[model samples]
Target: MLKFLKQVTDYTKGAVDAARFIGQGLSVTFDHMQRRPVTVQYPYEKLIPSERYRGRIHFEFDKCISCEVCVRVCPINLPVVDWEFNKEAKKKKLKHYSIDFGVCIFCGNCVEYCPTNCLSMTEEYELAAYDRHELNYDNVALGRLPYKVTQDPMVTPLRELAYLPKGVMNPHDLPEGARRAGKLPEEILDEMKETQDGESEAASANAK
Candidate 1:
């Protein structure tokens, strides 16, 4: 009789615990139901992108030296460079620099390898087209500057390397000390500041 009574008591305790858990879950559900919805309406409303968001690629013709570094680094061979040597001028002139968005993976390799910092990924992600052929962009189209240039802190290292116009630096180029410290050197920081200032001045001039 004692064993049977103990079992009944244990069963009752288990039932009570289950009911308590169910009640707590229901309470949480009801509380959430009272809160405002967080859903965003597409086309009408849009969420702000994160700092490091990479979208469409943009090219600055003035800054590009027709180095063909972007074309060489593209994994999918999407970037096309058409240039010819000007024998009299002793320089290479860019005839056409194009990119096909249909095959572009947006891997950012082209932008990273660009020694002149002429190539960049803009935040214009709305790239829908009825004709696939329309997605291919030539130098005349891609060379247009964006209305607003996003400054991503994640690309601080890239901006710092802008000081060395003829040199290109990658993440692997960082010194062991700087890499371990997770901090940029004073010289790099100064160079970044100068680059920012120069870009701002250029933008202002363009606005005029």
Candidate 2:
């Protein structure tokens, strides 16, 4: 009788523990059901990149003086600055400037160190091609305007979490001009300057 009672108790305890485990899993599922999915459908939907995003390189043929500053600064010595000295003008004339995107790493060093600000980083990152040779962009190709995601009617541009307002888990269907949660870097700097000014004024008053 004692042995039968012990076996029954053990079985009941095991069943209760199994039920608890199942309940816990179901609770987790229910909790997540209320939360929105944080995935992008990609190609159809795209996240708007930040203002300072560095993607592809843009070059201005007219602005570039064939200084070869880009080549000198580049870690790979990537930029091909073809120039010829014009005896009449007595200056270097840019002939053919080309950058191989396949071999070139988008470090933004060329853009940063350019004397004439001819080079700039664009948000156009779609450089996929079957042939690697097609990746090489001449001055004309580099001067082409970059396609923006927000401007594209086919793509649904969604803000990233960092760009979104506070407590906004879902970036979709957000209101236009919705300010981000925290103060901007500029705003923070302005506030700090104001506080320092106030402190200085207080110190002068105390000195008086």
For residues 31-138, write the lDDT of model 2, one tens digit per residue.
999996798999999988887888889989999899898999999999999999999999999999999999998989999999999999988878899999999999
TM-score of candidate 2 against the unseen true structure:
0.78
Model 1, 1-208: lDDT tens digits are 9999999999999999999999999999999887645554454444444346688899877777788888778887688888899999998888888898888989999999999898999866767899988889888778765533224332322222322223333322334334322334776899899999999999999999
The top-ranked prediction according to lDDT is: 2
**True lDDT of residue 175, candidate 2:** 86
Candidate 1 whole-model C-alpha lDDT, 0 to 1? 0.72
The lDDT for every candidate, in the order shown, is 0.72, 0.92
The candidate that achieves the highest TM-score relative to the unseen native structure: 2
Could you tell me the lDDT of residue 103 within candidate 2?
93
Q: How does candidate 1 fare on TM-score?
A: 0.55
